[model samples]
Target: MEIFPAVARVTFDGQVRSFDPSVERTEMERGLPKQRLLNSQVLVKQSMTLYFASIGDATTFESWYFDVIKRIGWFEMVHPYSGQTIKARFENGALGDLVPDEKLTGDFKMDTVVEYMR
Candidate 1:
């Protein structure tokens, strides 16, 4: 399994978590609705913001993102919300952009969304 690049001295923001349950529902004409789980495992999605303290750190991550992930489309990393290692992929095939520091400093920030593939 390929691990995400561990850029040093980066600040990690709290993850915004969401999930989609694998369920099917049916409504009876004269009774309560019935639901059944199609799959045991749900799909987990998380959005995370990373603040790179330096350009070097940002470049390292960018390289890995484009070279490794963009090609393979998925990788293993520690889940920001669950605190456990999981297989993940870029959400909706969207590759996030690296925004530079507003003050012209050699810093960068990136907001990314990842889906947990159980």
Candidate 2:
């Protein structure tokens, strides 16, 4: 699998991570709901907004995403929480939108959502 191209020069900001635990639950009429763990492993999903100081870096990422990542349908990236290289796919199989930031001088921004998979 191809690894995702890095575009961020510094830290990844505005990142949101969600953990979906496998579970089964049953509602009781007179008492608290009962739940059981279906699997020990939890699914991870992340949404990140990346900042690029250089337009060249942002364009590089866009080219890689279209040429490689889109074709492969999945890629490897370092998980922020786990700090390990993990296989990931674009959330809902959609490419992120790259736009120039007017608020920041000579900067670009892109937002992406990815789901980690085994």
Candidate 3:
């Protein structure tokens, strides 16, 4: 199996951007390099101090984040589009290679932090 190191940044406004240093076209074409590698896509959602929103409610915002990560091209699966059924392995980390820092302010702040590792 090959390991792809990635960095992602998420802002308070629900803007997310990602970068992967070891990602390449060949690696992406071959997917996650496991015969039984799970097929999944990464979906990111954020909740501010007073509001909650789902991916369906902000498709364009989610797409922007997805696009940044897709540039890394580290998976061997088809790209997922809105309303499309696709599978992809999920992974998460922060940009700058640091562990994510989270704080609680509201009733559901703890639930706001999400991470997926493949």
lDDT of residue 54 for candidate 2: 78
Q: What TM-score against the true fold does each predicted structure earn?
A: 0.81, 0.77, 0.18
Please list the residue runs of candidate 2 whose C-alpha ends up more than 4 Å from where it truly belongs after superposition.
Answer: 8-10, 102-104
| lDDT for residue 116 in candidate 1, whole number 0-100 | 80
How many residue pairs collide in each prediction? 0, 0, 6
Which 10-residue window in model 3 sums to the lowest lDDT? Answer: 106-115
Scored by lDDT, model 1 comes in at 0.74
lDDT of 2 by residue, 74-93 (tens): 78778876688888877777
Which pairs clash in the backbone of model 3? 31-76, 39-87, 39-88, 40-87, 40-88, 40-89
lDDT at residue 92 of model 1 (Cα atoms) = 83
Error of 1 at 93 (Å): 3.1
**Model 1 misplaced stretches (Cα beyond 4 Å):** 8-14, 101-104
**What's the lDDT for residue 66 in model 2?**
79
Q: Write the per-residue lDDT of candidate 1 for residues 1-118, one digit (tens) a residue.
A: 6787788222456468788888899999988999999998888888887777788898887788777777447788776655788888778867467788664588777777778856
Best by TM-score: 1
